[model samples]
Target: MDHAPRAPRRPAAPGSPPGGDERVRGAHPHAEPGAESDPDRAGGFPRPRRLPERQTVRDQVLGALRGALLSGELCPGAVYSAPALAERFGVSATPVREAMQLLAREGAVEAMPNKGFRVAERSSRDMAELAEVRALLEVPVVLRMARTLPAARWEQLRPLADATVAAAAQGDRAVYAESDRAFHRALLELSGNRQLVAVADELHRRAQWPVTEDHGCARPGAAPARGTSARLVTDATQHAALLEALAGGDLAAVESLVRGHVCGT
Candidate 1:
């Protein structure tokens, strides 16, 4: 009998978005088919979708502050004036401070000694290092999933992959990031190892910002320039092939494809 690999342990009930719970650019909300929901545009080009309206001052304050950080509007090492942001948001310093605290938790900003908070800065070296880690950890985890999981798990993840592809085509990095994450975690479930999954979770979350999620752009001569377009085509193609390999139980191919696809070498 071909023994199916059982999940090593119970997996976390897939629930809610990772890290910051609310929707924002580059922040994936509950995984759905609409991360790149704009009506007009080709794939790999993300339409500029408006952020959600905040139902509370706290949400608004956090939303604005987070936006400023991610868009490169706020430079690293620049001390943020909470009072000013509070004023700008038309709220009190309390909410702004709360928002800052939240950003610090996400590693998007660092708390300074006398300067309140500054946007987190990663050097090119840091980026490369993180990318290496992502290549190392995620590719293997995904390959294992491709090699192991049962049909039901693949069924659960297909919509996510499809959604991510759409999100990438539309250039909605946040939604694309989230759906991409969902697909990975769903794949990780095949390992049945909770600890690996948790580590994989944080690893993917950290790399979310700098990824080349431009599936619509990762073509041989058509990849998008800068980070505006996600470099998704290569990864997407590799992933799609891996999925097909999984369906067919091609372990050697999963191993080889994932490494070259993610490492680019």
Candidate 2:
């Protein structure tokens, strides 16, 4: 049978908006069709949409604090007042205080009766303990998933892994931390155990909290190495190696990789 000639493709006019199969920038990949038309469905998986007025303030404040903590801007031993943070973030003190209360509950910060919140300091022992807990919970689950989950699942997760590498290469500590979290969380979620994922996530966050002492050392008040971004680049390599080990069903290698990652040599 004869076929009609396909039309030549043409470039969009400058300043024209995307249409007809061109994805809108930042559109959620997992959103169901027509989700944009429904207010209730505007939010994407893993992140909430613009929240209600009251909740939006809390979210913004909390997010800002979390970023500061992960990026080492809020060092251990620093006492930060809610008003100061509010001024920094251009928000009200109430939301900042509310956010600090949540962080206190998470053990990321401590409430000071008259003074505001102080970043919680972790000892080497504390980090070691956190790593032990993480290993006890996460290692077996990940090994099992490595053996049972179809290879396609690992393939599907490559983008998240790549995101970690990209974030690390950019040397953005907060972005790397978040992308790293998403990579691990996506891996653990494959086990279909919500409670395990939740507990493991908390342990992960606690382990990453700023330490008063150098990692793996007894000395108090030691600083983290200046090569943190370089270390993350190494970590990205390990993440790729881990995927290879998993794809090969090497349980021993998987366990070793998991332990090294959790313990942070």
Please give the clash total of every predicted structure, in order: 14, 0
lDDT of 1: 0.63
> What does candidate 2 score on TM?
0.74
Task: Report RMSD (Å) for each prediction in the order shown.
Answer: 22.7, 16.2
lDDT of 2 by residue, 1-265 (tens): 9999998766665544555355566567677777776666654544356856555789878887887776566777778898988888898899999999999989999999889999888888888999999999998889888878877777777888888898888776667778888898998998999999898888887777757764222123343223267888888767777888888888899999988988886
- Taking all chains together, the TM-score of candidate 1 against the true structure is 0.59
Per-model TM-score on C-alpha atoms:
0.59, 0.74
Candidate 2: C-alpha lDDT:
0.80
Clashing pairs in 2: none
lDDT of 1 by residue, 139-227 (tens): 66766666556756666567766766776675545545566777777777678888888887776666554422221222223323223
